[model samples]
Target: MDLHPGEQILFAGRPSWRSILGFYVLGFLGAIVVGAIVKAVDKTGSGVLAFLVIFALVLLVGFLKRIGTTYTITSERLHIRRGLLSRSVQQTKLERVQNVNTDQSLLERILQIGTVDFDTAGTDDSDFTFSGVANPDEVVAAVDRAQRLDPPAAS
Candidate 1:
């Protein structure tokens, strides 16, 4: 979606490769299992096609998800858009942001990718989380600065 006039985007990002690595791993292991089963049972490569089909499906879904999901930070708000066929968009005003956090697991820390969480002032829970973002500390800093900026209405 286009931003309103006078609004400037501070940051735009997607979930990092770390977030979707599971899908690739699943496809790989599944193909191996299918190959083993076919080797043991058919020997004609009957289930080989099944493995290819499953792998293709998983790969497609992962690609589409990575391509379709986006997290955007604007001077006025934080916006997240996700979905392939149907888009879901959520935005919280900068003035409402209560806290910004970056979370990283041991593996993620090693990979240098993390999740950025945003908690708005009135919300009991985080308004949104950008998972597996590369260099999430920078994003968190940008979000913190944005949160400190006055909202359009206030200005």
Candidate 2:
């Protein structure tokens, strides 16, 4: 993330590892099933290899998704950045932030990870979100602090 000359980062983070727990669980189970099928068919014990390859691919995808995305809160803006090689950035001024909402399923609540959605004034884009963040309440607090501490400069 690049900061402006006087900008200060209030908070910066990536999605939590726990957020990909479901993917890992499903991937492991799928690998086991595929491995068993391959072993039963070939009788060469290649099922182990199949399982390892499938599980490795799943892990790689999950790792990339988690690592490639970033959420940042600064004294003057809120930013969401995605992708590793090719990048996309979305930001809104602190003064434009109208609402900050959080969503957590029962499992997510137990895991202490959730999604934070933002509503910015005059923006029709509803896809602005910080997904799978740990301690979403802290993110909200950071936004509030940023807005409070450094009020937007007059136009």
Candidate 3:
């Protein structure tokens, strides 16, 4: 659907299975560390196994939560909705956008997914990123169009 005059979608994406697998691998490593610590303290294999299983479950839940979040861009503002338990909604007005950056890592390039980073004029850091977007170029074009259509107010 076309964005409304005052509405923009910052990002719409489905996290690749590859990305989810990567998280799982990281979780495995974390599980190993926890297992080692538990084994050192208790000298029991059950503790290690239990910790590993719990770690895997936690990572799976986290991956699911990440998949649920939506980051959007509207004509007037940027919006981020994240988390299942304690949801977070952060909005940044279009007028505050100072810079836009696009980046693709090796895996992202291979998978044709890129991230768009937005730098707000008064923010401490550029933490707003549109992750795993399929067509970053199109998004950039849209952002440019929005900026042109809505010029910032004079200081």
User: What is candidate 1's lDDT per residue for 1-155, written digit by digit as tens?
Assistant: 68887788899999887788977998889877876787688877767776887788888888898989999998888888999799898888887877788899898888889988887877765548887789999898888777676667633
Q: Model 1, stretches more than 4 Å misplaced?
A: 124-127, 148-155
- CA lDDT scores, all candidates in order: 0.83, 0.93, 0.70
TM-score of every candidate: 0.87, 0.94, 0.63
lDDT tens digits by residue: candidate 2, 4-73 = 7678999999999999999999999999999999999998889999999999999999999899999999
Query: lDDT (0-100) at residue 133 of candidate 3?
Result: 67
Q: Please report the candidate that would top lDDT against the real structure.
A: 2
Shift in Å, residue 22, candidate 3:
1.2
TM-score of 1: 0.87
Residue lDDT tens for model 3, 34-101: 88877888875766686768687968776776677776665667776777778876678778988888
Residue pairs in candidate 2 whose N, alpha carbon or C atoms collide under 3 angstroms: none
Q: How close is candidate 3 to the true structure, as a TM-score?
A: 0.63
19 Cα displacement, candidate 1 (Å):
1.7
Cα distance off (Å), candidate 1, residue 109: 0.7
